[model samples]
Target: MNYRKLALTLAVLALPGVANAHVGLHTDGAMAGVSHPFSGLDHILAMVAVGFWASTLGGRARWIVPAAFVSVMALGGLMGIYGVPLPMVETGIALTVAVLGLLVAFEVKVPTAAAAVIVGICALFHGHAHGSELPEMAHAGGYVAGFMAATIVLHLIGIGLASLRFGKAGLIVGRLAGAAVALAGAVLIAG
Candidate 1:
């Protein structure tokens, strides 16, 4: 879907988002909302995997799982914005990457209620990382809104990617992404 254009657009759009620079966007784009998912490899991979697996499952889960993650992640962002302290923010983010990656790779199936809780918890960690990393000039609310919006878009992109007719090739690539994410998580934990 015009990935080259998208990448170029993001580079231009991401310049002012200096705060997101910690994860490697040149500027602090505290206001990009759901699109924030692509700013960092860790966030992008895990969030995409979430969407991919959700799509794979189909049914109510197709939407319910990602919805749960976004809802709880909003709450977590609120907590962080309001100055609530969460220990090991980085570690939590790393663990989420690893866990979700594995979940996608293995096609782990859990009851809906349990699945919701798992997604919610992971979302909190993700949101908090976004909130805490905001640049100094950006308002907390605006910044959080921006990253949140960016995040949702990333999920949608993942869904789109999964919908492709790559057959076994697609599955193989998905598994590789998961393995890479898990490996990154391990390194994050070790650090």
Candidate 2:
């Protein structure tokens, strides 16, 4: 991978105005929703961490964990849309990154169902955040689809990274990435 090109691409995608540029503002709902996840470093990191942790589990968890996250996330989105209040959503999201990154860094092993539950709880906060940001004028269905697609894509990217082979180097790199994510979460909390 061309590190420079990747960095530039991510930088461009994460511009401040991107997340607030909702479909109700100017663009179509789906596109707006799709871009929203990439706009926030917090969302992006936590999502990718989900995939990293899943891949680390190395079994049926590879699929079940992400599936559970997506499924429960939808329910959380509905709760947000319906005006259900979840306290400390931002705190929850940041803590999710820290916890998930620790799981990846340490190669923690837990039952698949337990892992699913952990990720599912985190996904609820994420989904609710997305839903709360939804524009009234936007097509709700399209917006939901867009964010969900973007989220899955991010997860896949993390999974792909975890699947690569650099011999023993891969483990080191993975742990380093996890540490970076955790540090980012700490910064988010502090800032």
Candidate 3:
């Protein structure tokens, strides 16, 4: 009845749920490619995290790194659609979560190009999984668009959040998040 109670309730309802599966996973070719990024928690987190990292790192990395992720992810999706099999796609996706999380958690900074490449590799696995799993969606086209739109929004949020404080505070939080992501990855691997 009160504002506090209402906010808490809203938060709980907003959390990830099983029904999320219905939100994405269609493959209307290019349309699906565009949308798939937003459908799942893993993809959303990973994508957004890149944007945050890019913004924090500043300069070209802000755009380059996320762009690398999306581009390579698209390639991976194509591979999946064509049945180009990659070993442990699911595990790879999990690993991506963990590794990227660590990057955020630790605030690890490497060369701009290197960071992009690393994220790109991770994106590939994530994208492939999405592409391969399209059949479950029934009508893949709209699903892709939904997912893609969601994905971009998440990225923007990450960029915005990184700017919330900037400087030392943002740096600390970014590293902490990276560590959290790593932990998440470990959990995924165990599962």
Top lDDT: which candidate number? 2
Tens digits of per-residue lDDT, candidate 2, 66-127, equal 77887887777778777899999999888888888888888789999999999999999998
Return whichever of 1 and 3 wins on lDDT.
1
- Model 1's lDDT to the true fold? 0.72
Off by over 4 Å in 3: 1-36, 136-149, 166-170
**How do all models score by TM-score?**
0.77, 0.84, 0.73
What are the Cα lDDT values of the candidates? 0.72, 0.80, 0.68
The clash numbers for all candidates, in the given order, read: 22, 0, 15
Off by over 4 Å in 2: 1-28
TM-score of 3: 0.73
- Residue 61's lDDT within candidate 1 is 78
Which pairs of residues clash in candidate 2, taking residues 3 or more apart in a chain or in different chains? none
lDDT per residue for candidate 3 within 108-164, as digits (tens), equals: 788899999898898789768876766653444443433344455566667767778
Q: What's the TM for model 2? A: 0.84
* RMSD vs true structure, all candidates: 5.6, 6.2, 8.3
> Of the pair 1 and 3, which is ahead by TM-score?
1
Off by over 4 Å in 1: 1-36
Give the per-residue Cα lDDT of candidate 1 at 63. 69
